[model samples]
Target: MPVGLMLVLAVTLVFLDLPLVVIVLFSFNSSSSLSEFEGFSTRWYRQAAENPDILAALGLSLTVAAAATVIAVVLGCLLSYAFVHGRRRVTRPVEAVAMSTLVTPELATAVGLMTLFTTAQLALSTLTLIIGHATFVLVYVTVLVGNRLRTLDPRLEEAAADLGAGRLRTFATVILPQLRSAIAGAAALSFVLSFGDFVTSVFLSGTEIAPLPVRIYGMLRFGLSPEINAIGTAMIVLTVLLGVTGLWLQRSRRSTTTSNPL
Candidate 1:
């Protein structure tokens, strides 16, 4: 926490982010040369805008991410709730199993999922992509929900019950509201992970259902393109904006809760 060490850490962080900065800068370059630094222009952006394939991939990625996030939110919430409220012996093992997904390598998981789908004669379509994305996203959702539930006061639910509210009503009116931030954060993280996912998507996505990350990977095989840089730069900006908004909302909620303590 010393000032000099903090400065060094800040500089190191900036160095780590330099690649992204380079991508954003190269995105606006007009020159066809991918190797050399070029002056700023929106030519690559224009090309990206006109490329129907890129647009289609982006649309597909969004759709898959949205669908997967929705599934994860519901399933994660249910799993977390059961684990948190159920008998200790049962819930402990169940929670551990649910979180074990995070311990496995993503490549191994994708390969396993692909093998299973192939064995079942399932088509590698958008549906498969959503399923693949959801598989990993579910763990994130569970982690978020479980962490929030751990911090929540069980007395709130007890109080609601003491007032004659049924378990369902107490959960809907009391528990769910307190979990809003975690839910939103988890959903956002899932969406980003799904959207940015390349390896799983590449294996599960069919010829017709290519997502943006897969498309970007394909483009890379042909060598780096300025348009790819442009697309990546835009994605980086959008991601940063979303992250800032989520953090701001989290802080604002905490401040409100503290100021209006009951």
Candidate 2:
């Protein structure tokens, strides 16, 4: 690469990572001061662990994310199958609407969800939060899995049929295996999005339960603290781990396919 391009890349990376680096560093600070780090300590992390509200919120977030991911993956895979196999005249318009969710402002989606729930007399609660998350998350799953499906040779299914395999058996043994990597990636992405979601959670969460991001925002109303930094650092760590795990799964699947070629 050119020296100028390398310099620009370095600067961009630093610009993006500096804030996260500061948060991770300050999470271990002995003092509450954000400006000056007074030495290393795990005090903030311990405080966060001890906080009942934070723990509850964290648990709720995990539950919602897991549920939403499962829903997104199942619905998304089915939608992807439809997009590939169904008539284009029927699927094309639906695909456009589905993809539009990606570009739709999250705030707008949140507001729309809130309004729809109110109009339908559905209470804003954990269920609503999961529904809101899965609605958008399914689009991601569909896109990834649909792309994979499009690349697949349809003759595999036909060959299986010729061998006396039923539709369900063919899908279970052949199609699902091929989609493992995409499904894994989609599930990981869905979980991350749901866990980190603040706007939708803000609008949909009930008085009894709030996700971690919403809980963190509530904490900020009191002012910044090292405990908040600790929580933020923990969330960052989880997101990175999920992303790495997804990539590892995808690569491993590819390697297995290459090695076996069956």
Candidate 3:
């Protein structure tokens, strides 16, 4: 590597990961001081597990992510299929709307959604958070699946129709199978984005419902501690696991597609 490029890479790595390394290290700290790590223990994790507020926040986050991921997957896939199969004039406007959401800032989306709901006299709650996350995450799904659909050969659908297969049957057996990897990737990416989202969650959530990221941000105002470190470490591990699982699913699906005979 070039000397300057190597220096830039090192700086980027440290800037991004050095604090994470510190948090992971201090999560096991026996000392109370954030700067000093006297010894290692899992006491903080246990304490976090026992904290009611943390537990509630974690539960809310999981539920919201689950609901959002499923809804986004369904709606996004439909949007993808429509973009690929529908008339260009009709689909272009829909695509524009979707892309606008994807490209727009998260703070803007959050604020806009919050204001809309308030104007409509709707209270922000768990349901609103789920809808907010679904709205955000589905953009990723639509883009991913729409690209996959564009790459797909239209002849395959025609061939299935030539065999006298109905539209729904051909879609279920032919089209859906081809998009498995894309769908799986969309689901995983959606989950991670929704679960880790703080800006949208904070803006849409009421005092009664707090997702894990919102709770963590609230905790930061008071101070930092091993319990917070433990929570951060846990979230990082979880996000990694979700990404790995998605990759594995996509890989397996690709293998199956390549190995199967027509």
Candidate 4:
């Protein structure tokens, strides 16, 4: 790489990751101060684990993320298959509309969801947060799985059809197996995105319940505590793991495609 490019990359990385690095370091701080780290300790992590409110918020976040991932994967895969294999003229416009969520500001989506819930007289809770999360993640699943589907040859399905297999059976036995990695990748992405999301969770959640991110934000208002750092560190580790897993699944899908070449 050019020297200028390398310098730019280094500066960008530092700018992005400095906060995370500080959070990880401060998670072990013996003092309550955000700056001037004292002796290292895992005390905050223990405190976080024992804290009921934090635990409740974490549970809510996980539940919302899991529920969203499941719903998004199912709907996204079906939509992706239809758009990829079925009529383009009809599905194309709809596909664009569905993915418009990606470009739409999260604040806009959050406000819209809040408005919709109010209009419907549905109370804001974990269920509403799950719905909000799913709306955004559905686009990720659809884009990833649809791209993977496009790479598949129609002859594979045709061959199965020629063998007198029912459409559903062929899909279940053949196409679904091929789609396993893509689905897994999509699920990982969906979970990470939903878990890390704050705006939608904040808007959709009732005052009675807060997701982890929102909880952490509330914690920051009073003062800096190592407990917040501990929670942030845990979340960073989790997000990294999920992101790495997604990348691995995508790579595995490519390998499978090259080796099988059907």
| Alpha-carbon RMSD, each predicted model | 1.7, 1.3, 1.8, 1.2
Residue-by-residue lDDT tens digits, candidate 4, 93-167? 998898898899999999999999999999998889989999979999999998888888889899999999996
- List, residue by residue over 1-262, the lDDT tens digit for candidate 2: 9999999999999999999999999999999999998999999999999999999999999999999999999999999998888899999999898899989999999999999999999998889998998886889999989988887878899999999999789989989989998899889999999999898899889677889999999999999999999999999999999999999988987797789665
lDDT string for model 3 (1-262, tens) is 8999999999999999999999899999987779877998999999999999999999999999999999999999998889889899999998898888867999999999999999999999998999999999988999988887887778889999999999789889999988888898899999999999999999999888899999999999989888999999999999899899988987887677679733
How many clashes in each structure?
Answer: 0, 0, 0, 0
Candidate 4 lDDT score at position 43: 92
In the range 225-258, model 1's lDDT, one tens digit per residue, is 8999999998888678767766776787678778
- The parts of candidate 4 lying over 4 Å away from their true place are none
Instruction: Name the best candidate (by lDDT).
Output: 2
Report the Cα lDDT for residue 177, model 4.
Answer: 86
What TM-score against the true fold does each predicted structure earn?
A: 0.94, 0.96, 0.94, 0.96
Error of 1 at 24 (Å): 0.6
In model 1, the clashing pairs are none
Q: What is the lDDT of candidate 1?
A: 0.88
At residue 40, candidate 4 shows an lDDT of 87
Candidate 2: residue pairs that collide: none
| Candidate 1 residue-wise lDDT at 212 | 93
